[model samples]
Target: MLTDTASLQTVLDVCGVFVFGLSGGLVAVRRGLDLFGVLVLAWVAGLGGGTIRDLFLGITPPVAVSDWRLLAAAVVAGGAVFLLHGVWEDDDARPAGGRRHVTRAVRLLDAAGLALFAVSGALVALSRDAGPLAATLIGGITAIGGGLLRDVLARQVPEVLQRELYALPALAGAALVVLLDRVDLLSPLTAWLAVALVFVIRVVAVALDLNAPRALRSTPTER
Candidate 1:
């Protein structure tokens, strides 16, 4: 039987996969991709992070590949988007707020995926007896890797590399999970709290259009 932590981690992982898949599907729709392209993007965005994480941890044939449910979730998410995108895209039939609604929905899905993946990744690392630093790093990677792959496949700049607080929030959440675990305070409640922290931070960053500081550049000398 799975322990409470393991069970919660599994739930988080599956939820993350679904949300990320939805995000990928939305992106595919925005990019005007075909049905096959939509499915491919969803699959990669849903499973890419977990696959990379498993490989990094030496778990051959990652759970994303070995598990059928995760794959189904991706396919379903993609198909749903492909079928329903027309509803949102019908400008003459769409409500005045339709475009704003779509944007908000996509942001929310991305935030949820990032938060859940961060927590799930940390929990998986902890289960593997990885150190806190490694756990934190893996968690952040797991959160961002899918989006990175999705953006690349869609021929856009990866959000994590952009001047957004995306990766930082994920890393912070993962670090928090590691810290709580180290102190024997890592419970389902704490894990969810960490996820919420990440979500809130990311949403706020997006709403505020926040960016990390860039290096100073010297002013050009007058000719």
Candidate 2:
């Protein structure tokens, strides 16, 4: 059972990396970045969060750096985007709907990546005997760190800082996993459910244009 669980975790992590890499590549494509830039962004988006998590845990060399398979996944995802983006592009001289399609695709992919990484990150932290608070924090970081880096590189505001409900869903999912683990109910099934929950929340939030409350204007003080 332990071996199977470990294998499952590895699979989830790899899938998350690949999905995030693809999302990153698509972002680069939307930004009109060159092929090399796309690849770099893909690698950074796929592995940036994991690298930060590993470093915080004092794991030397970071799995993102040492695991050739993860690197290959990023590279392959980037290459695929480079090869297939032209096919998706509307050859029309007008650029009207083209940007919308790309934006929608990027958001959907980002949501998937966010959900997968959140669960994987929490599981990894639990496996490493991290406390619940630490696990939740790490999980949120794992989900958003890569995208944050991607946006920064692309010269845009990170989504986490925006008015969206992005990090909330990730942290909520991570908290669910931790709670389940505390009750000794942490199974692969439960983990996947957590992932689904996060994904649904994020996607719905995006579709509905939901935004978290921002600071309201203060009323002027009467003299």
How would you encode candidate 2's per-residue C-alpha lDDT over 123-201 as one tens digit per residue?
8888899999999999999999989998899887787887669999999999998899899888888888999999999
- Record all residue pairs in model 1 with backbone atoms less than 3 Å apart, i.e. clashing: none
Q: What is the TM-score (0 to 1) of candidate 2?
A: 0.93
Number of the top TM-score candidate? 2
Q: Give stretches of model 2 more than 4 Å off.
A: 1-3, 91-94, 218-223
For candidate 1, write residues 83-191 as lDDT tens digits.
9888667853555466676667777888999999999998898889889899999999999999899989898878887776999999999999999987888889889
**What are the lDDT scores of the predictions, listed in order?**
0.88, 0.87
Backbone clashes in model 1:
0
Model 1 vs truth, CA RMSD:
3.8
Candidate 1 to truth, TM: 0.90
